[model samples]
Target: MGIVSVSMPEDLLEEIDDIVETHDYSGRSELFREAGRKLVQEFREPSLEDRDLVAIVSALFPYDSPAVETKMTELRHTHASAVRSNSHSCICDDQGCVETFIIEGELATVSEFVRDVEATNEDVQVEYSLFPVDSIQRPTL
Candidate 1:
């Protein structure tokens, strides 16, 4: 319908192409369109009733960004009560790092913390996305 230009590393583009071929997506545009729709639906600001939901929050940034590590650490500490688990890893292409925080609490808390982290991420030029998911932890018998 519309065209948007995005810059991605060569390897990442190749991987997209591979996924498109393997998964039978119409093309790169169709592949990205699906991803875009999913992101929008998951990341949109939640209504009051949805505030108690749990979700996984993801962030990507250059590993060497001057303030990324510190800022992320600060946010984690600031929201320690809500942030349940965290993980960090180098991206597949090695252009940057990726981090994930599995947060459990009311949606309000999760959304607020994610917004703060995302704003700071913007200052650092980091990419961020959040996906809402059911709380997956199960109780032992």
Candidate 2:
């Protein structure tokens, strides 16, 4: 490992010293080493920020239509690499209906899939947005 120098405020340094002592670390070097390892692992692993995304799709489709289901299935298959989860709900009326889908995928793939699905279905009016994926902690119910 190469040696590097960084400046920290006195208060932060004191906090680091306290952590080092509490953890029984040999010194600040060991404490920083472990923290760096964890930081690297957190970024390297495919956390929500990397692979998690939510797409909320609002579309108009015929009542009791198979088109929506078919399109969703196609999207799932085509973008299987990015998908983590999905859910669908519908609100129907006489003229047409609005369907909503919550889909999780990589940002690019999910965006592309949404575009393709919208293009393929003429009768359906679709709008989609990506929800932020928080990786700092596990999602709570």
Candidate 3:
């Protein structure tokens, strides 16, 4: 086995230590190994079929980058059919911005929107979570 070095914020390290104790992990290495496996597995999963899905897409970038924001706006307009709603907020005294898009549509449409947002720019940090709409149980009338 090879050893790798990592650096993290003190607070994050503290949180990892807390988890180590709470979850009975042997150490940080063990916890990190498990987390790595989970992340890899998630990425390796096959894409879902074009089923109904709802997704919340978020993009974070510097507030001064109007180009990035403009690209996101264009993409939003291009995918307007899938976008249900959206919200934008400034963070860290306007140094950065976070834009959230609530989308509901076929899985392919939502996934395309997410891919477009992620490919906006290297500086833009994008994250999204999607859930199948059919998974929700509704009361029978």
Best by lDDT, which number? 3
Give the worst 10-residue stretch by lDDT in candidate 2: 42-51
Question: lDDT per residue, candidate 3, 1-141, as tens digits?
Answer: 679798766877999999999999999999999998986665444554556788899999999898998997898899988888988899999999999999998766876787799888877888888787878899999
TM-score of 3: 0.65
TM-scores of all models? Answer: 0.54, 0.45, 0.65
lDDT of residue 7 for candidate 3 = 72
Whole-model lDDT, candidate 2?
A: 0.68
Clashes of each: 2, 0, 0
Pitting candidate 1 against candidate 2, the one with the higher lDDT is 1
lDDT of 1 by residue, 16-116 (tens): 99999999998999999999888666556554346455657778777677688777888889999988888888876777887788777765686687777
Question: TM-score rank, highest first?
Answer: 3, 1, 2
Clashing residue pairs for model 1? 51-107, 52-107
Off by over 4 Å in 1: 1-51, 123-141
RMSD (Å) per prediction: 6.0, 17.3, 5.2
